[model samples]
Target: MRQEITSYLSTIKNEMYQLTKFLYDNPEESFKEKKAQDYITKLLLDKGFTVLKNYMDIPTAFHAQIGEGHPKICFICEYDGDIKKGHIYGNNLSTSISITAAISLAKVVSKISGSVIVIGTPGELNGGSKITMCKQGAFEDIDAILISKPHIYNIENPKCPAILPLKIVFEDNLSGNLTSMDAYIMTINLLCQLAKGFKPGCTIENFSISDKVCVISLKAPSFDTAAEIRHQIEILTNTLGELIGLNHEVTLAELPCAEIKTCKTLNRLFAHNLKECGIIELETDKCVTSGSTLGCISNTIPCVNSYISILKDKSIPYPSSEFAKETLSEYAQEIGLKAAQALAFTGLDLMEKQNLIIEAKSELIVQSN
Candidate 1:
């Protein structure tokens, strides 16, 4: 069955590349991905799957489900690329790989039982739609969620640290005499002091966005710690506002403290599939603390965010590099194909191997306990 799946995917490889090219050539911003959504929904619909638009009441989001019955699986696709330009981190490539894998599994659904869902999550550049969907129970019934991201190595199960996104503004103009530069300097000084215990090289630290306004974030081992830090910062901000003769307001967006609790069985399966494709998994490839919307989905369900290295310059990995001009580059195509083939193999395993699914569920239960 695995061989058959591989052979089938080989036949449609060109189609996948074409879709990747189309999305790369025409990029869209978050919540404004009508054309991208149209293409994705049409592909899934053409494959006889049921595609639901306005997912979670978000106009740009979508949920496409195929097959039926138990052991339902999901694929996460960030169809929204970089704002104004084409795919910078090769997100369009990731989307294409995910779409092709889901559709490939759909074609073989008769031989294997279970279901597949391709979730169109937008706003990856901002606070992503995945968080909203997870909060609203979008992944409530999914057994596993698969993600393909760019990296310099192949990671089995990555862990993301607890993070808080915060923004504070000084409103009262009683200090109407205060210039933007003055406000910035004053707020930055207060923020620097308030960022106690959050220093560079520490598990908990302040990652401030340098601008006229004081926008910052706190990362900690747990969400509670992050929240507490935010509270302290707010109190300090209020005190600073009073001293500076300005009123202030602070906004905080807190995420789950839970790590991307990985299912070992699924990770092992993915590693095996990747090795089959000449991709080596190393023990030194440790989980790094990075921020991604995948954090929300993994917190909600058994999900794995695997990174496939596609480094042409050796300096720019998938998360930070722009490939708009390299849409048809050989390096980009290679990465896209590897991502699609590996993910498709894993999807096939999830569908056909009941014992594997049982093992994955057991691992999740044990870890959760």
Candidate 2:
């Protein structure tokens, strides 16, 4: 079965490459990936998967599926690009890999008693589309979720921190003396001081600031810690406003993202498949974290969000023009194909073995608690 999967993916490598190149050539931003959505859905439809466009009331999102019954494996596809760097984060490669895996798995799903679902989740850069879909129960029936990302090294089970983005507004109502910038600076100082005492690993960044408002992000190892941090920040902001004679408002900038709960059962399966695909040197020592919306889905279902190295040079930082260019290179195409093969292999394993899904779900239950 593995050999058959490999041979089948090898034949469709060109098609996968074409999809990646097309997405690279025409990059689209979050929630505006019309071209990408149309192209991918059309391709999936042509491949005989029953596709539901405009999934969960999101125009750019779609759900494509094949086969039926237990152990329904889901492949998440994120094609939204960065606003400035355009596919610099390798979303094009990730989407292509997901589509390739789903299509390849569909070829053999008839022989098994499982299903394969390809979910087109857009707005990963800004809108948190997956989070919205989770609220809408998009992944209610999924047994396991698999996604691969392009990175500087091949990694398994990277830590993704729970993130909370907020907009803080300071209004000088009494004396009109305290400017918003002053409030922002003061808040930053307080947050820095507070962070020193936080037990859980956390980070706070002020991403955007204007005359009257500043947008800050909080990341923590878990949602409980993140919410605690938010609570502390709110109290501090209110105290500071009172002391400075200013009015303040704190609002959520986006949906709060949950930390990834990687299923050990799934990770082991994916690692075995990755090694079978000739990826021997896996990086598991370094601690890596991402603010991806996929973390939201992983919080509920068993998931494996692995990484495939797209750049040979480790110094080229991600979300840069150079990294974006590397995503279009032949090396990236090869890596993407391998990742797809590994994902499909893992999906096949889950389909053929119900015990694996049961173990993965049990792991998820324990980890999520």
Candidate 3:
């Protein structure tokens, strides 16, 4: 079965490259991936998968299925790229790998009593469409979710910290006590002081200040801690506002991203498949971190966000033109194809082994608790 899947992916490697190149050349911003959605859905339809566009009322999102019954395995595809730098984050390659994996699994799904689903999740760069989909019950029935990203090293699972984006507005009191700018400067000083008392594993990741608004991103080891930090900041800011005769508004800038809850059973299977593909040097550090919307889905279902090496030079920073161009290189394309083959092999195993699915779900329940 592994050989069959490998052969099938090899046969379509050129087509996959072309697909990646097309997405790389024509980058679409988040929530506006009409061209990408059309191209991918047309290809999936031609390959015999039943695809439903406008998924969950998201115009750029789609759901495609190729099998039926229990142990419904899902592969998540993200195609939205950076607005200015194009496919600088390698979403184009990730999307190609996901589609190829699903197609390869579709070939052998008939032999097993399982289903394969490919979900096109857009707006990961800014809006986090997966969070909205998860809220709408998009992943309620999925047994396992598989997704991968281009990284500097081959890793089975990377620790993704919980993050909360907050917006603080300081409105003038009109009593001439102090201007909003004065309040903003005071708030920044107070926030810096407050940050010194934060517990270990918590930090202020980034922040920005405008004329009357300040946006701060808080990061913590867990979602609960992140929310607690946000609460503390709000209280402190409101108190300062009251003392200075300034009205303040605190609100969430976007959805809070939860830290990834890895399903060990699924990650082990994926690691095994990756090793079979000659990717034997896997990074084992749990502290290696990256941000991802997969954290949203992993909170409910078993999920694995594996990493494949896409950059030949390690020092090239991401979101740069050089990084974007690297994604279209031959080496990156081959790595992406290998990742797709590994992901499809993992899917094949999960479909054939019912106990694996049961164990994975059991782990999810225990982890959630």
lDDT of 1: 0.72
**Ordered list by TM-score, greatest first:** 3, 2, 1
lDDT of 1 by residue, 60-136 (tens): 88999888886787888887777666687677877887887788777777777888889999887666787778889
The sequence of per-residue lDDT tens digits that candidate 3 reaches over residues 43-108 is: 899888999999999999999998888779899989998777898778898999999999999988
TM-score of each: 0.86, 0.96, 0.97
- For every candidate in turn, the CA RMSD to the true structure comes to 3.2, 1.6, 1.4
Model 1 is weakest, by summed lDDT over 10 consecutive residues, at: 200-209
Question: Against the true structure, whose TM-score is highest?
Answer: 3
